[model samples]
Target: MFAAFDRPRISLRDAMAEALTKVPDVEIDPEGTFKYILVRVKDGDKQKDIVRGTKAAEYHNHIFDKVKPALEALGMECECLGGGKIEHNGKEKKIRVFGESTAFGKAEHSVSVEKLKTVFSNYEITWSDDKK
Candidate 1:
């Protein structure tokens, strides 16, 4: 049995995963927990996508605020950190993920590369399982 509540308890990572379905060009902590979300932000549309050049960051914030609860229902965490930009392809891509400096999963836990590829698509994304 569960207690009744008005709002759902949502962490930050879940939000980022959903955002990936749309914005799949950001870096996350190796683990699935919230630790790093480093990307530029925009209005989640093409205009902002080109102008501000941080669609991933924008969607990151959007998920934490709007859809985090939904993601929690599915079971995950979502977080937002400071702003940053990363070099990818021939341009600097904005970066934003989840979690603070305290999350253990940040550098400890790991995720399935195949799964991440499924989410982020295969363009410039590359990974080699260190554990293997």
Candidate 2:
């Protein structure tokens, strides 16, 4: 026997997961228990030079166009955190990922760190939550 209310919750989780599949190579936290998803670009040595100038802006725009909507579809308020530079290996590098923050709904959601890693594996996308 199960509570009738539990069905809708399960449905929503499934729906959210289904929506996420639209984004190529994306992974949502399976727990879906995050308050915010921190998206940051990794500034590794080789990528330092390429993710600069117009290229960076273009990448951000692409994220806005592609990633933002997918998150929004899952009921998240997406915030764009433009380009940023970080010091890695003692070198200044431009961050590539554009999505920085997101507010989650009152339900558990799934987050695929691996998928995010794969998609922006070169740039390094990270998520932040109250739990952290």
Candidate 3:
């Protein structure tokens, strides 16, 4: 497999930005703690929030901002990521973290969700259900 930075490639953040730009409704939680896993919002694209000046993209950026570093610190390979829709609201958001399935558990998901809740108001663990 190719290495993470085999060709004097850019820093992790730059690489992440480039990748983030490729998705439809994507954002990196600006206040998130996970470093490697580029989490994105998975829902609300079709909701009224879109027309109500709720930039789904910005929300995503906020999410990734908050979670990535901690996911990385938990021994989760940040660069190795796969994500999709889960849930969302003005305060709480949820997204599925996909990978080799062997890496995560429900408790890990709970901790991350709780952390996000702390930063975002009333951001309750609406659900922490990442089993795969």
Candidate 4:
């Protein structure tokens, strides 16, 4: 018989989903979060504002450290952009965190997607260039 220690480990995606519930102004999109990270890795230069508010920024900053090594292993470099501002519809909005990736391409993108699938196998991930 299998020991309790042999039980499956909880995935990072699931852990993130659970942690996200405490973050302010974030609609919990477990699948979308993975997709967003993948897209950031694929694009490699585009800066996407992920969330807003101080609590959200703090959350992203804290989580990025845990996620950085995984992206690096897939040949991508990522950073959390804090204290940034962007003009949206003639109003200056504070950007909680920006998602930016560097040094990744088609191969890395493919591999990253597969890795995410393995980590978040509970979701059916669809590839889309559109940032929704």
Which residue runs of candidate 4 sit more than 4 Å off their true CA positions? Answer: 1-109
User: Can you tell me which runs of candidate 2 are displaced by over 4 Å?
Assistant: 1-57, 85-132
Query: Cα miss at 19, model 1 (Å)?
Result: 16
Q: Name the lDDT value of residue 19 in candidate 4.
A: 44
In terms of lDDT, the poorest run of 10 residues in model 1 is 44-53
Report backbone clashes per prediction: 24, 14, 30, 0
Q: What digit string (tens of lDDT, one per residue) describes model 1 on residues 27-62?
A: 343322232232223322321011011234443344
lDDT of 3 by residue, 1-132 (tens): 778657785866665555433332222333322322223322222110000011243333343444546444533323223222233443334433222122221123333344345444444434334332
lDDT of 4 at 99: 30
| Candidate 4 backbone collisions, by pair | none
| Error in Å for residue 15 of model 2 | 12
Better of 1 and 3 by TM-score: 3
TM-score of 4: 0.25
Q: For residues 6-28, could you state the per-residue lDDT of candidate 4 as single tens digits?
A: 98899766554444333222222
TM-score of each: 0.25, 0.26, 0.26, 0.25
lDDT of 3 at 36: 21
Task: Give the per-residue lDDT of model 2 (tens digit) for 1-132.
Answer: 668857645555565555444433433222212222223221211110012112222333443455556555645444433332221211221122222323222111123334334544554444333322
Candidate 3: how large is its RMSD? 15.5
Distance from true location, Cα of 61 in model 3, Å: 16
